[model samples]
Target: MSRVRTLEEIPLRKFHWQMFFYTGGGAFIDGYIIGIIAVALAVLQPQFDMSLTLVGMIAMATYVGMFFGGIIGGYLTDIIGRKTMFLLDLGLFVLASIPQFFVTDPAQLIIWRFILGFAVGADNPISATYMAEFAPSKQRGVLLGGLIALWYVGYGASYLVGYWLLALGDDSWRWMLTSSAIPAIILLFARLKMPESPLWLASKGKVKEANAIIQKIFGKGVILSESFEYKEKTSFMDIFKNGYGKWTLFIALFWTLQVAPAFAIATYIPQVLGEFGFADGNMEYLGSAIMSLFYLVGLLPAIYLVDKIGRRPVLIWPFLVSSVVLVVLGITSSWQMSFALTITLFVIYGIFNTSMNIHQWIYPNELFPTKIRGTAVGFGTGVSRIGASLSTFLFPLILSKYGLEVTMYCCAALFFVGFLISFMMAPETRNMTLAETSTLNKPSIKFSSKPSPKRETV
Candidate 1:
């Protein structure tokens, strides 16, 4: 009799690609939801007669919702199962998205945007967990990174949509905000066929159910690996105990430092461009659209290098290069700021900063065990959004009061601090199995708890 193949040993198949497309669809919509609003807010500010503070509140509200959604949705994902939460969140996205077309006041708009953001937040950890649990260890980086790449694609697409729609007269922002519903509805229906994660199922001791899924999807030749037998009681607190506390802290820190500036800058790139010289509204929106391409270029190299050279190098080196770029831009903010020089610096920063951002999806999922992966990811997402929310809210206030030089300097400092922390703490998980890379195998690694001899596998 032939030995049954493990999920790790199987070659990439049609199922994997289809799964990524279906699972990754949420990310595309997430990109559109956030990205469209960057330009939409430009119109919203003047039309709504919003104060700078009110504009900031409207901008910050989605992330505030993200903060709550990540925590609540993440816990529920682990408890109720990835498949259930997967469809439900997108439904929320649809319901929240349609109301944007009808809001009569700033408060009503903020409420709808917050609800849309909640859906996006819940989908973040859920999609990452689903992809990671099913992906071959060798290709996990690309699969996870591709999910983020889709986010940029969605973001970039939104810019294109917003740029064109800006020509549609004063009410264009409504259409831009409501457009997210199209993708959200499509993904909700598409994902209904996706199976529950086999690894998650195996971890729950549903071996028969898991094996049926394995054979059904991966073929009759594949079976549950021996590693799946290990089982233990899981708690929400597990992510904070057993040496996980340090990882939890590291993920939250790096995630926050990376996103706070990125989100702030992306959210207000038009205004930043205005300061630099592209003061025309059309020109500013056009420039922001072009900047999206630079980010996509940066992500391509990272997807290749992540599994090639290892995670530590991919995470560590980009932080250094991106930080240096920001420092240069900050120092030059006092100069005349020629278009060529300004665009060059912005392009370089966008590329490298976006490159490093891929790890936000990769790290938290890799660092924790299957049992607590959702909770850990949720915690990281929620904490990072707190920073993002504050930065988005405060960015305009600071820009108005302190000028671009001060704002650039502050962001530079944050990126440099991130470089230092990542250098000291980033772990290498290049070729290791999920069970091996997580706390399940390495007990002696400082603050971690000892793993039991029992193991779980898919």
Candidate 2:
């Protein structure tokens, strides 16, 4: 009998790309749902007569919901399994989005937005893990990087939809919100036809099932002889029991710092443009439209370079460069200079920020064992959502109190913190196996004495 080959031995080709698309569509749904809300707020503020503070509150509500959803979803992902949580969360997003069209009050809109955010929060960990688990090692970076690119595509699409709907001027915020439902539906159908993660199956001690799935992907030669032995089922305490406590803390802090600047810029781009002397009417929308194009362009190379250059460089350099650009924008008084500076900063920020965002999904999933992957991801992401929520609330206050210049300076400061954190602590996981990556910084226990050899054989 011939021995079976491992999955890595299989050729990389269209099959992997097909899988990337199916899984990536779920991410697109996630991005579309979240990104569209920023644009819709511009239109809805006028229609509903909302105060700037109230609008910020509504945006924060979504992040608040995301905080809880990420925690719950991450916990459930390990408990009920990834596929189950993925489907259920998709349903929640679809259901939450449909109600926005019927909202009669700002308060009601805030409630529904929070609910939608809770459901959408599950996407980061689940989709990233799903893609990583299924991808061949050689292509993991590109596949995950491309997944991030697709997410930005969704972001760009949201802006395009918002711009077009607002132009209709027929009270079209409903159309803007409803547009999200289409992607959600498409993802639901696409996911139905996809297979479960074989790595997850093997980790759960279902070797035969895992092997069968692997065979389908890699042909019949892959072996199933390895045991599915794992440490006892993990709990929240496990992150601390091992030496992972420090790592987890740093990751959570890193994510918090990351979201602060990114969300601050993203949530207030239109308002920021108005400050730069762009007309409050169509010109605000036009600036956003142009910025969105730059965003998409920045996202592509970031994704392409993420795996090729390794995670650390891709993550750190972009943030550092963007920080300098943001500082320049904050200090410049010339409207034209500030506008060009803001666009340049936004483009660089989008690229690095998108790269960091993609890795946020990938690294957490890869950092822990399958038993604890969901929990760690949820905790880290949930904490980050808290940061995002705070930033959303604070941005408007900063704009009102100190003006856009000070607010942007604050954003630059946040990015500087993130840059330092990434530079100091983040691990290089590119092309490494899950087992290899999980052991970083773990302590080795040395026995006080070596055990004597058994002498009973005679």
Candidate 3:
């Protein structure tokens, strides 16, 4: 009896872009909400008489919400289905942002951001798995990389928007925080038409429905080989016992370390630049926008290289280079370089840090089966947010007390640990079908000597 063709065997088409833009919409909003806060905090903290610690807490709040949202959403997507979480999460995000425009105090802003963060957190795995499952294996890296690249674009966009919105005067922070709702609103309508992932359908044994979707995608009737079969049930423990648990762990741990430095530094870009004479609300937002632009630029080359060089090499080398960049940026900044030179140095730093970060963002969903992809990705992402939150919470105080040089050096050292993890431990799965990489085709630990001779699949 013939089954449906596996999702990877299907050709790419306009439907994929629909999925790309639909899912990317939420990601764009998440990045915007996360990015605009740097300037928003700069605007609001002094207006409200917030201490440095309160500033950190306010900054840390959204990440804290995202941490749990990822963990919960990850599990729910697997149990419920991808489409449900896709719409519901973005709705929650929109609902959370509505109150931000009305907030009068620090605690109110923090609470709203946390709720918004949870909704943003929930979108991560749902979008990652949705795109990975639907993408053709050969171009999977570019597609997933594209999904992540737009996030940086969103980050850059937020700063750009915040810069102009400063015309709202002190109230720009209100507009900046609330503006994330716009994209989330658009995604809800666009995403409603999206079908369940064919892989997710097949996982539930809805073979006819799964085949129907693939037919729409491939524009012809297709057969599902036995390779498409996936048990309806999944467990968190399964990720650990299966070879995939290691991929889960690497994705989580590396993301945690990578994020510790990225978000912590990005949060205070305005403050950091102020030392170089880029003060005032408008100029601060402009400098912050420029800082974010390099991250977006860094993602450009990855669109070409991630599929060509393979994930491990692309992931490893950029991380190593970014680590060096961080250390040198630290050393240079300590000496008080010319203002023009200082901004240029940080711009270079943004390129490498963002390139490596995009690679890290795409890893987890690509390495697991649909049955557990959401959970595994969520588990890793949730843990990483905690690390990110801690850094956000602590970075302000650390920088204030110890100076910029110490913080920069410490961030560089953390990224070096990320390099070690990617270089020494991360597996090469580029160009392989998810089943082949996840080893669902053969039930054995991949790290064991002589992993059951490689088995190719549709």
Instruction: Judging by lDDT against the true structure, name the best candidate.
Output: 1
- What does candidate 2 score on TM? 0.91
Q: Evaluate model 3: give its TM-score.
A: 0.93
Clashing pairs in 3: 3-223, 3-224, 4-223, 4-224, 5-223, 5-224
- Number of the candidate with higher TM-score, 1 or 3: 1
lDDT of 3 by residue, 336-438 (tens): 5766677677777777777776665467876777788898877877899999999999988988999877888888888889889888877676677776677
Per-residue lDDT of 267-327 in model 2, one digit per residue for the tens?
7778777877775567767677677666667666666776677778877876787677788
TM-score of each: 0.95, 0.91, 0.93
Judging by TM-score against the true structure, name the best candidate.
Answer: 1
Ranking 1 against 3 by lDDT, winner? 1
| Sort order, TM-score high to low | 1, 3, 2
Write candidate 1's Cα lDDT for 343-404 as tens digits: 88888988888888889889899888888888888888889999999999999999999998
RMSD of each: 3.3, 5.5, 3.5
lDDT for model 3: 0.79
Q: By summed lDDT, which 10 consecutive residues of candidate 2 come out lowest?
A: 449-458
- Number of backbone clashes in candidate 2: 0
Worst 10 residues of 3 by lDDT: 446-455
- Candidate 1: regions farther than 4 A off: 229-231, 444-458
